[model samples]
Target chain A: MTQPIRVLLAKVGLDGHDRGVKVVARTLRDAGMDVIYSGLHRTPEEVVTAAIQEDVDVLGVSLLSGVQLTVFPKIFQLLASKGADDMIVVAGGVMPDEDVVEIKRMGVREVLLQDTPPDEIVQTLTRLVAERGER
Target chain B: MSRYVPSSELVERAARGEVPAIGRLISRAEAGMPEARGALATIYRRAGRAHVIGLTGVPGSGKSTLVAALTARLRTQGLKVGIVAVDPSSPYSGGAILGDRIRMSDLVNDPGVYIRSMATRGAMGGLARATLDAVDILDLGGFDTIIIETVGVGQDEVEIAKASHTTVVVSAPGLGDEIQAIKAGMLEIADIHVVSKCDRSDANRTLVDIKQMLTLGAATSAKPEWQTPVVGVSSYTGEGFDALTRAIDRHRDVAFGTASGSRRQLAIARFRLEKTAENLLIERFAKAAVTRAPALAERLRRRDADPYSLANELLAASFERGSAHERDHHRPPHFAEDHW
Candidate 1:
C-alpha cells in the first residue's frame, strides 16, 4: 500500500536562507512526503494555517534566523485553535539546544540541531509514520 | 487506446488497477484540466503512504542521474518508487518533452517503479501544484517514495516545496555567480543540500560556498534542530547514492515530529483552495468580459464610454459578489471553456 506523507515545511520569519530547506524539501519529496513549502518571510500564522489546511503529517519549519520562539508559537497556537493537537512539528536551523527545548514544550515533538543527517530525519519520520500508520 | 474521459470516471477506473485510465487522467492534467481538482481530492483521501522527495538544481546539476542513482538504490532496498521527472515546458508548444525521464530507462519498465514525465507548465518554479497533484495520486496509488525531479532549479524551481515534504537543492562544480545570483526566496527552503556531479574540479569550492551561504542565512536565537548537511554525490559513477539515501532517511525519520503535521496539511489545502478559486474566478471573469466584449467595445469605440468604466460596469456584480477574496479562497469549474 502506498501512502504519501504530507509535510508542510515553511520559513517562519524574515530570514530568506533556504538552501538547506530546499535540500530537505527534495529529500522528503523523494522519500514520498507531499511537502508544501510556505515561501520566505512567512508569518507564524501563515505557516500554521498552511500546515492545517494542507493536512500535513509533518510540519518542518526552517529558520535561519533565531526567532523560533515567536514563529513556532504562532504556528502552535494556530494549530491548537484548529483542533490539531497531534500534528508533528519539527524545527531545523542554527538552533541552540535550550531554544529547542522551549519549542518542544510548546508542542513541538523534535528539534533538530544543525548538522543532523538526512537519514536520521527520514528515519524519525518513518518510525512516526509507521506508528501513526498503525493508528 | 488511451483517451480523455470524465475525471471522476477515469479516476475511479484508474483506482482499480486500470493503468491506461490513470495515464489518461494524468495526461489531461498534463494538458491542464480544471477538473483535475476533483481527481486530486479523491487522490488525497487515499494519500500519505508514499515518501515524497524533490530534487532541484541549475542545469547540468545532474539531477536526473542523481535521481536515477537514488531510485536504483531505493529499488535495491525492495521499495517501489514513483518518479515524476519534470522537463521545462516547450516555450512554443506549451508542453513538456519530458526528456529527463529518458535517463532512468533501466527502471522505467520495472514493476517496482512508475515513472511519469511532466512539462513545467509555467508553474513558476519547476515545482507546480499539478505536479504535486500527480504525486498525490501516485501516493494514493501506492508508491513507496514519490520523487519529483526538476531538471534544474532555475528561476522557476522556487515552487518545489509548495507540494513536497522535503526539498533538496542540488548544486554542482561549475557555476560562477550561483552564490550571488541566488534569490531570497530560493535561498531559504532547503532541508538538504547536495553537490551533484562532485567529481568535477571545483566541486569542493562549490560545497564551501554552499556552506558559507547556509551560515550567512542563519540568524540569532534560532538554533534549528539540524544544520544543512552538504554531501558530495556523483550520479554518473554510482557514488554517494547510499549516503544520499541515508541522509534522506535521517531527515525524514529523525528531523520530523507530530506537533506540526496537521497544520502543514492545512497550509497546502488552503493554498490549493485559493489557487483553484483564483483560476476559476479569472476564467469566469475573462469569459464574461469576452461575451460582452462586442457591445462594450463598440460603445467604447464610439466614444460613448471609457474602457475602464465599461469594464467596471460589466464586472460590477462579480465585484459586488466579493468573489475576489472568495476567488482567492476556492473555486469550481464553470460551463464555458477558453476555447479559441
Candidate 2:
C-alpha cells in the first residue's frame, strides 16, 4: 500500500494568528496529505519532537508573528540535535524576501510566503515530497 | 535516506529505547510495509508487559485534553507513557488533520512520554488498523503504560474495548439528557466513565446521569468483578484527577489480577485474531481484484454472471495464488516455535 505523505504544521512562538495556517492545513488535507497541526504557541523543542514522533515527511512552521528568523534556526538546530535533520523543513506566513533567503540558507527546504496561492502551495508541497522520493 | 536498513537492526535499536527507531518501525508498520512483518512479530512477542489503556468518547468531549491531563498524572508516578492518538481521514482525499497533539503540547518535550498521532486511513470503528501494532512497538520500547486515544466517536465504536485492558469513556456536560440515554451501546463498554469539564456546573448532572445508568445496569446484570466508576474532572482546574487515577488503577488491578481477568484476556485475544484475519483477507481480496475484477465486472454488466459466484471465484483465485506465492518464499518461524 502507498503511504500518505505526512506533514506536521506547527505554529511556533507567540503567534496567535492561525487563520492562514488553518487554511494551509485544509489545503494540504484536501490535496491528499496527512496534516498534523501542532496548534499555536508551540516551542521549537515541542515542534521538533512532534515532527520526529509523527515521522512526518515535512515540517511546516507557520509564523505570522515575525519570529521566522529566530525560530526557524532554533527549530533546525533542534531537529539536527535530535538526529532528524533529514526531515524536509518548510516555512510559511509573513516574511520579507531577504529573511526568506536567510531562512532557506538556515536549511529550510522551502519558504512559502503568505500570498502563495492554494493550488501552488499544494503543488509545491507535493513536488517537494516527490523530489525527495519514497522513504 | 531511502536506503534500506535491516529490520533486525531497527528492532535492536528500538529495544534499546531509541525513539527514532521506534518511530520508524511504527511508520513502516502503519503503512503496512511487508518488510516490517518479522520485526513486528518480534515486537509483539516482547510486548504485553505495558498496561494498555483506551480513552474514547464523543466529539467535543475533551478526550484529547483529558489524555494530556491523564498522561501528566501518570508521569508524576515516574511511569513512561506511550500515546497513540487517532484522527479521521476524509473520505474524498484519504487524508486527515491530526490535531490531537495540539492539546498535548506540554507532554511533547518529555522523554518519558512518546505520542504518535494516527489517521484512520479509511478504517472504520474509530481506530486506525495499525493502532495495536503501534502500542506493541511502544510496549517493547519500555513504556510502562500505553494509552490509545481514539478518534472522537459515538455509540457504535466500541472497538477500543476489545483492544484495551482498561477502557475509559469520557463524557462532557450539556450534550443533552436523551443523547446520553441513547448511548447505551457506549455505556456498556466503559470500565470507567469520566465527566470532563467539571468546572461547569452542568457537569454534576452528567455525572449523576451516568451514575444512575450504571447503577441500573448493575442491578439487572450479574454483579461484575469490577464496578464501573463515574468520576468528574476538569482539565482546567485539575479537579478530581487523583480520584480518577485511583479508579483507573483499581480497574487495572481487577483486569489483571482476578480469574475473570483471564476470561477478559481470552476474549481480547479472540477479537484481535478475528479482526486481524478479516483485515488480511480484505487486503488480499483487494489485491486480487485489481488484476481479475475488470473482466468479472464486464461479465456481470452483461448479465453473464451474478456477483456472489464471481466473488467466490475471486476469493478462490486469490487464496490459490497466495498459497503458491507463500510456497515460493521462505516462511518465517511460527510465533509458538520462534524462541527469539
Best candidate per TM-score, number?
2
Regions of candidate 2 where Cα sits further than 4 Å from its true position: B1-4, B220-223, B322-340
Backbone clashes in model 2, listed as residue pairs: none
CAPRI classification of candidate 2: medium
Q: Pick the candidate with the highest lDDT.
A: 2
Model 1 per-residue lDDT tens digits across residues B1-340: 2123578876776566444455445655544455666776677777776777877878777887788888889888888787787766545434233346446645533556666656555556565436767776676656778898875666555656655666788877777676557534455667678888777878888888888877787784132555667888887676677778888887666334533444545665676677656655665566556556678889999999997899887775344343442244233444232331
Interface RMSD of 2: 1.7
**What level of docking quality does candidate 1 show?**
incorrect
The TM-score of chain B in candidate 1 is 0.80
At residue B89, give the lDDT of candidate 2: 95
Q: State residue A113's C-alpha deviation in candidate 1, in Å.
A: 63
- Best-performing candidate as measured by DockQ: 2
Question: Tens-digit lDDT track for model 1 on A1-135?
Answer: 134455667776689898998787667656655455555766666555445433456788887799988887777776767555567788887877888889989877777666989888877877766665421
- RMSD from true fold, candidate 2: 3.3
CA lDDT scores, all candidates in order: 0.66, 0.86
TM-score of each: 0.60, 0.93
